[model samples]
Target: MSNSRSTKLHVAIFPCFAFGHITPYLQFSNKLAKRGHRVSFLLSKGAQAKVEHLNLYPNLIHFYPLLVPSVDRLPPGAEATSDVPFPLHGHLCIAIDQTLDQVQTVLSSLKPDFIFFDFSLWMPALAHQTGSKAIYYSVITPVAQALKVPSKQKPEDMTLEDFMQLPPGYPSSSVRIKSKDFETAQLKVVANDLGTGMSIYVRITSSMIWSDAMAFRTYHEVEGPYCDYLRKHYGKPVLLTGPVLPETPATKLLDEKWTNWLCNFKQGAVVYCAFGSQNKLQKDQFQELLLGFKLCRQPFLVALSTPDGCATIEEAFPEGFEESVKGRGWVYGGWVPQTLILEHPSIGCSVTHCGYGSMLMVEELKVAVEVEREDNGWISKESLSKAIISVMGEDSEIAGLVKYNHAKLKEELTSEGMQERYLGTFIQNLQGLLD
Candidate 1:
């Protein structure tokens, strides 16, 4: 714990099973533990093992079991949305519903000072029953909260095009979804319930309603207006808890093969590309992206997430594709240590899904120039190549902006001291209740 004088409170965190959600919650748990607070990280049987392996704050944090109920179509050990196909996400939500009884029991017994949850809409009510303060710790942006569907509009009635249209109360016209990027079929399925009883949007709306306060995984400098909008829209206190930054592990040499591979490139020369865990690109789009990287002929490292039952990387790759880009690029299947890669000297830019976790890390480092796939959704081979070249090309303006913005954001995120200060305020606010 830092020497900062204060009170310590027990904080319980219940993150969804996905790595995107789990990583931030773990970081938040570490942050609270570092402040000399006891943290109970409630995990489903599936997520517990993976999280325990991370060896984060072993002494400060305690792990508790939350059962993931058996659901049809979902594999036995699967608890996270990332563990299954994107289409199966609703099933995971249904499985999460099973945890209600277990969570209530464990939480009531532990009776922590505060309980933090992600996407668990029932948590706030559970916290209330247990005499614990509840905070909805959102990993996604405030945009979801800013846009509210009219009472008359049912999600089932809305099409992908309808969803793409800007919702009421949107602060700007700049946030509309693009045609290519919108997954109509997949989203339509997710829009309706898969035995979860409530849709994902309903879960989000209800969580905000039942919580004591809302905590966002963003800062005022970047999304102040949206945060302000959310406060008014929800009629609740919204706390912009600085981007929950992950601490670099001390022993990151888990994979020496990639470590040696990355060191060969010049400083700020390699393009690091990874679309988060849950996003799945059709085979054609994946090939186009690969061809684009090959077209640029730059040194790059791309991590591709193969679908749930895909045979191998070879199955997904174009014939002879690996041989063609052998020296210039490396395409790996499954998990990549993004933070370690970003910290590498050879890393120059990242082409990512623009997931908040990835973006916040890139912004914090201010090192890698980011090219988000979500910016224009899907693009042709030529456009994809152009985007890569725009970032990698010598004397390109985009490269310059990447360098400048990285430094500026890094300074702002650190120097502003918002994360630490906001966390202190959060503790104080909760402490006041006890007083």
Candidate 2:
């Protein structure tokens, strides 16, 4: 280890075995590598292959593929959570758990200054054994963590009522789980007992308690109170990386097919819709969503996974869906360049499932509206159409207000030196920990 503060640090990153997790970790790695630090990214072989193209600084950021051991119920060659359905994700966690020895061996050899990880509760101990500091880096929002502060009470003892109630001294009243959504909240918060024989609550809390420091992919301006709550509860340094969005490679280009198709629409005339890769809607709900797009009567593009029980998007399409929206609507069942599409001049509004990042935009920032769901937790086509209209209608006041707010927020986030300042402070904190 070097004595000076300016000396480059070696950092290791091993996030949970999901693309949702891996993608963020890799983005963080890119930031570190951009700052002239050496980063060793520990992940499964398959995950490495899938994200190899995303490694912008291959010279400084290295991939060390861990050999995921065989586990019963985990399909052959399945290394990441995306390789199988959600229910089988537990088995993937088990496989990841089995890689602890491999990770330790690599850590010992590399002798990094710090290791950043989530989900692997045993990582802090390994880091200690290898003379490295552990940073429990959470990709989840601090607001969510603050809602369900971990307790010594076992998972079996926790009730839905327990989860519904926010933690003492919780921060925001605007960000809350409604009583109707208590069951879903409970399932996500404490009931998630993965294949490692540990609930997600226990895994995260234990990791946070043991790690040398904690980090989040957010800044204080966004979630200051929630971050403070975690810092006070855990009594550890809570560092922020801001939003570590990866810089697009100069050589990368949007696919020609997408470019050609989007060119047909006028400026700011098309609505783009996509749920995340992991979200597979039921057949009925899928058709309802497509019908909602048709009801909106606007040019739209939908890139989503095939609906459950259907082999292809075409098979699940509503009767005459293609005919009703010919030349205007396109439904694709594969990945597209999302960032590029969002930047396209032809795109006006986006309909999403409110994944972690976008949820803040809808709920807290008030830059987007959520489609109302029925008591049965299903969204009606009319509700979706109404939400789209509220944001897209030229004369609508809500549309104008949200658009102005979104533009202001975007400008602040992308302003010169904003990201640099966050990353600079983050690196200083890491060095301070070592000192």
Candidate 3:
């Protein structure tokens, strides 16, 4: 169990198709590699290309590419969930399942001491076949994972209102939905049901039963009770890997235009809005978010991710809306260096989709004012305005609490803090299981 050079473990990591999941798995693999362990970080050929752009330890962490088969109504070479339209994601899952035989073959050949697999339900089977200890690494929040704890009644069988309620026997009411707030309940349910043959829930619960242990990309300080609930329900050792934070963009001056624009505002005067890479806002909802920032009359920098095959960002904006808010708003269509933006002095609060990876980074710096979505995943202009005001309001108590929690969480989740507290013991435990 010691971190001895002679006792190094060879670990294989297989994350789900999404970059959100893939990115963190890579971070963990790098951590393992830094500790003198060897890692075979496996992904689809397309996903391999995506990770290559990030920091990769070539000598210690090797890449193994799996070819994803084409699915019905899904285009060829679309291995990632983000590559396809929202409705066709089910087809992507079917394609992922088809790769199981190939994965089993590869795992058998590699014969790694352990297999760290993502949320794919079919994955543990490969680990089982290869006699490798299976570990489930969840990239989502603990609350979402808690809500997913297997229930007697299927989620599809219940009403949306009923579906919003936390399954019975959960240890806390903090995440429970007494009303129609499904955000606290099943924000991920839609994606879960989008799979073709096996439902996302079915895969999740099955893996919980099959896997030797479960790991979360979260820390106990933030969701300790929920973590405890998962341990009791799944009957396994649940490990917190701390928040696997993304590396900030290397350069401070990431973009000239955005940098100059952000400088115009006073300290803590701007609202930074971004709904992660995968979330594509509809035309109406997208306009409403823009208007919401205007309504608050706060200087803002917003990154609006255009839907697949949609018109350009300029066309998507409401007629004259951009010009009206021209002096105060800076709207962008695609990728931006978010960590650098958050670090800017004018940036005050954030309005986010609460994506696991985005929230992990956002929470480490400033208070995140999360906007709730409707059934169609749209937030009204009114709701958006209220959230912007609540977080950016100078004398707001809620804003203060959010900032305090961020400071506390940042202290606990720093790279050195995490490796010393959780990941070190996590490896020791895995070694114990191996022996």
Better of 1 and 3 by lDDT: 3
Best-to-worst ranking by lDDT: 2, 3, 1
lDDT of 1 by residue, 380-400 (tens): 667667777876678988667
* Residue pairs of candidate 3 with colliding backbone atoms: none
The 0-to-1 C-alpha lDDT of every candidate, in the order given, reads 0.74, 0.86, 0.75
CA lDDT, candidate 2, residue 196: 59
Q: Tell me which of candidates 2 and 3 scores higher on TM-score.
A: 2
Q: Model 3 reaches what TM-score against the true structure?
A: 0.87
- Name the regions of candidate 2 deviating beyond 4 angstroms: 1-5, 151-157, 181-190, 355-359
Residue-level lDDT tens digits of model 3 in 1-435: 464535889999888888878888888887777678899888899888767856456788888899999778888779898888777878888888888888888889998988998666766777877878899888777766776665654434434444455677765554434344445344446434675755666666677777999888777876787799999887899988766566554553557777788889999899888877778877777887888888888988898788545678878887789889988988898888777789898998777765433333434334465565675456778888887777667798867777787777666667466655676777777787776
| C-alpha lDDT (0 to 100) for residue 361 of candidate 1 | 39
The candidate that wins on lDDT is 2
TM-score of 1: 0.87
What's the true lDDT of residue 264 in model 3?
A: 94
The alpha-carbon deviation from the true structure for residue 178 of candidate 2, after best TM-score superposition, in angstroms, is: 1.5
TM-score of each: 0.87, 0.95, 0.87
Clashes of each: 1, 0, 0
